[model samples]
Target: MNRIWIPMAAAMIALIGAAQASAHESLWIEAEHLDGVRGYCWPMGRPKMKTTAGHWGLSGPGWAAEWNMGGESGFLSIATGADDDKAVATKTLEIPTAGRYFVWVRYGDWREQTERFQIQIQQAGGQPWTARYGERAIVEEDNEMKLYWDWVFAWDRHEVELQKGPARLSLASTTKERSPRQVDVIVLTTDPSYRPRIKERPGNHAWEILQSYRDGIPDGLEPLAKNRPNFNLPSQWKVRTFRNKDFLYLWNVSHTKPEETWLGDKPDRVKVPYNIIDKETREEFEKTYGGRDDVPIFSDPRIVPTFHGVGAGIFTTDPKTGELLEAGKRFAAWLDADPNRNWAMMMNYHPGKPIGEKGIQAFRKYRDRFVGSISGESLGYFYPDAKAMQQATA
Candidate 1:
């Protein structure tokens, strides 16, 4: 009875999952499928009669795959030498039936405002109609640095009437620039409600939360065992011999590539120091350090590297004595030697700690030291008052 019921339950679950997935499938057309043709070929400028021009091939690497639908890598680029010189790339797309369709062009704009083009579309028996399209200057410096191809959603949607069979879409550069405009892909859908897939920029809080979760470290906790400093020490210094149990162990703790060390040689034959910890010491270390069994712990008195600008290290001593050497002594000395040294600490506080007056003061101190943005959801607690929160957000 149990076996029979289980099979029925599993089949029902599979059917529900299939229904949910099928709901997202929609009718659409990809630009790469359209036939491409150019008046002139490459090298000798031979004329070709095909739909697509090999001369105006795919754009820069990774641009087509990222912007174009169906992960296509081909695009049509038409440039004109002089204002009178005509260079048009025509793409022929076959339609099932004559109807109204929504059109979208995946394009980028890095040219001057005056350097624009006209998109001409011709139905089966109809004459060509043109639409002027151009891009405006980006005000943000960071957004301007992105490749023009990365602006997938920077296009406007236009409605076009088609009469079934085949339609000719042409892109002709109206400017005199050497390379006027780039068209990654043209998407046409019968459903007027359809919207092109685009990447949305995350807000400040969302971006902060995303970055916080990326390093696999818990919120408000620093990655202690990952990415150690490259000290470039001799091979002999890689392994240290201790009098207790006569065990050879590695000096560094790594989440992956445990055999690698700052000493530059593989500790293939050496046993891990954490695995060889005595039962009593292991219990004590776990109690003091919160017994996180997920990551390997270094059981030696060594310097744990950090990404802090001051080159600080977390110095750990004997677990039984609970001794921790001042972690930032080396960093302090380095800063003292050069008073003008620009350095800041990458701090990770306890997640459970309340965001109070002390936390706000600490955040301000860190913000002044670090010349850039300090991101983390943990910092949100520093703004307890409503006005302070508003000011911080602003």
Candidate 2:
């Protein structure tokens, strides 16, 4: 009985040891850590020698650097000249007891340009298998200027099969000329669905709503068309309702830049000068009205028109029934009363045409009537200023 028990215990120990060995064989190779075969270097163009730990190598003619951003230790970036050159990084990893392994690559395209590259793996007694990667959807980076990098980990499961002992894993960018591709790291995992921990951008609800609108209309609404009038609004315009407390507001957020541009082309059309005021004029205006009874008004007309409306208006409605409330009627009446007031103000201070005393007074009055905080339930209209409305008609 003792002899039998000893043999059984030995067998269990051997199985546990094999499991540990298998786990140890998995690889996590950093691109910058690979052996630099021919021409890879650090940030200052310093030469990096080949080693078992890994190094970077570049062939042809280009520059490379170590970029540490988005919580990565240091990713290799071929900053420039890769368009006419090739960059490659290679490493030798040993597989203790390999069967099938999923491959995951961590990389980034700072420029949002789809960069293409290939991963070649040569097993002990097998031909090299090259898996191409790139043309991935551009992931929004916190910093889009390329001053900082936002790394994305894209993976292909069970894509690589390895044998026991040493295997040469390499990433080569030797195809068509283009911008340099960012390489962070490559991971091999027995778990097919394994994903490395990395920071991800927060989701925006407004974007989600916009995406939903693009995908399909909500229930009970008319099928959306680029040209459809609703509730006396012109074609290509509609009211979007929003509620706050007891009041519902009608908002028409439409694109009017094209129409505005066309209106500018007409000889008789009144063009509202936007961002035409030079810095010098703004400074003079501030100095002249530094502490006068009149409020100093210096704003980017282009932004102002866009912010207010091409025919943008907000009016109040009965929250429960969606019927126009008294406040809503009043708001509409105000819009109709002097439809040209807003646009006239915009055009008064056209570029090279300084704001006269009359223009200043008119702007003050316009501000008092149009711009105010909305509290509780209220009605409003985002109608285009009189000029835009006229242009639309013309």
Candidate 3:
């Protein structure tokens, strides 16, 4: 009876060990940790990489917050700038006791911009299998579109089968020259019910390494820390809402220098669906989109008229002469001459230099047209004499 009891107890211990091993079958592959093969970009170039402390609810050392603008930390960026450009990131995934592993990749799908990507897996002596994804409708919640990183399962084409060894896993872009798509991490799990939560899971070696790298930074090479946006403005001025009559802003339309090419012709720079037109280019623009009301420029709910912001030296003194540029005067006349040009034209300024008494007086003539200096949102901080400048505009 004692021998039988001892054997039963040993069997119970073996069963518990098997259960524990099966419970920990999931393996996390950090996207940034993967080896970049081609057309891959470092996180240092984008605010998402520089600002996010730790993505997916994971944070530790090396996770220094630069601007705290909110984005993923240690994420991989796949560039898509040219027709022939292709981005690929690969890593060897270790399978503990793999039979069939579900591959999950976390990525940002802001406005369905990052909808084209592929997840490929290859086991030893086996041909590679690709699970392709394509454009998906934007997921919306609470009357707003979602723009955060979410997980997608690689199960469209085939189930990923792996042996209990190393398997080559890759993420590749399938778009023809566009914005970069960011990938945060990948998870390979044998448990059918396992789904990644919002926070970081245990056993993230890449996260650990990032912390160590941050801890080892020398004295002055550290990145400059920046405070987040100040949302503490007055209640009425807190939110700037766009009205129906508001137009999309465009600058440098009045550059008289022939050497400075006009950016209005560039589709990338002038991203509106309608071709920009004024008194000079009206006939040319009307030839294409004049009769079509269904075109995006007319049909899109978010479309607005283009606001031409003409730059003049008086808004900020001329670099050499400290006098109002003749070109600025000409643009103001051009904008005023045509009764049809009432769609929001303004004077653009640099404001990096002090607007002397002369410049300030010149600005008073058309103060209503000036929309804070081209420094944009930092006008309060970057623009010298904020109160004086505001009073002049007011």
Please name the candidate that would achieve the greatest TM-score relative to the true structure: 3
Candidate 2 on 1-394: residue-level lDDT in tens?
9999999999999999866543433466666677764454222232232111222343212122221334443433322233423656678888766777766676555445565777888986689988877655445544443444333433332377777788888777655434445566677766543555542212334555677888777788765586765567675564542211222222211223323321234443223222323568645654554433333222222122322221112232344655544433433344456553232111111122223343344344455334333322123334457998999899
When sorted by lDDT, best at the front, the candidate numbers are 3, 2, 1
Q: Worst lDDT window (10 residues) for model 2? A: 344-353
The sequence of per-residue lDDT tens digits that candidate 3 reaches over residues 248-304 is 443333333311221123332222224433646644544555444554443453432
Candidate 1 residue 56 C-alpha distance from true site, Å: 2.5
In model 2, state the lDDT of residue 318: 47
What lDDT does candidate 3 reach at residue 172? 75
Number of clashes recorded per candidate: 5, 27, 1
TM-score of each: 0.35, 0.35, 0.38
- Per-residue alpha-carbon lDDT of candidate 1 for residues 1-394, written as tens digits (9 for 90 to 100): 9999999999999999866543321223333343453342211122231123222333332333343423322423232322322556677767665666666665544434333566788875678767766545432324533344333224555677777677777766555533334455566655554555442221233456678777786756766678877879988776653322233322223222222322123333232223223667645654544423233445242322222111121222224544432332333333355443233223333222233343344334333332331222122122267988789999
Candidate 3: which stretches are off by over 4 Å? Answer: 1-22, 37-70, 73-79, 82-85, 112-114, 138-143, 147-158, 177-179, 202-394
Output the TM-score of candidate 3: 0.38
Better of 1 and 2 by lDDT: 2
Better of 2 and 3 by lDDT: 3
The true-versus-predicted C-alpha distance at residue 226 of model 1, in Å, is 54
Candidate 1 off by > 4 Å: 1-55, 63-85, 111-115, 135-153, 178-180, 199-394
Per-candidate RMSD vs. true structure? 23.2, 22.9, 18.6
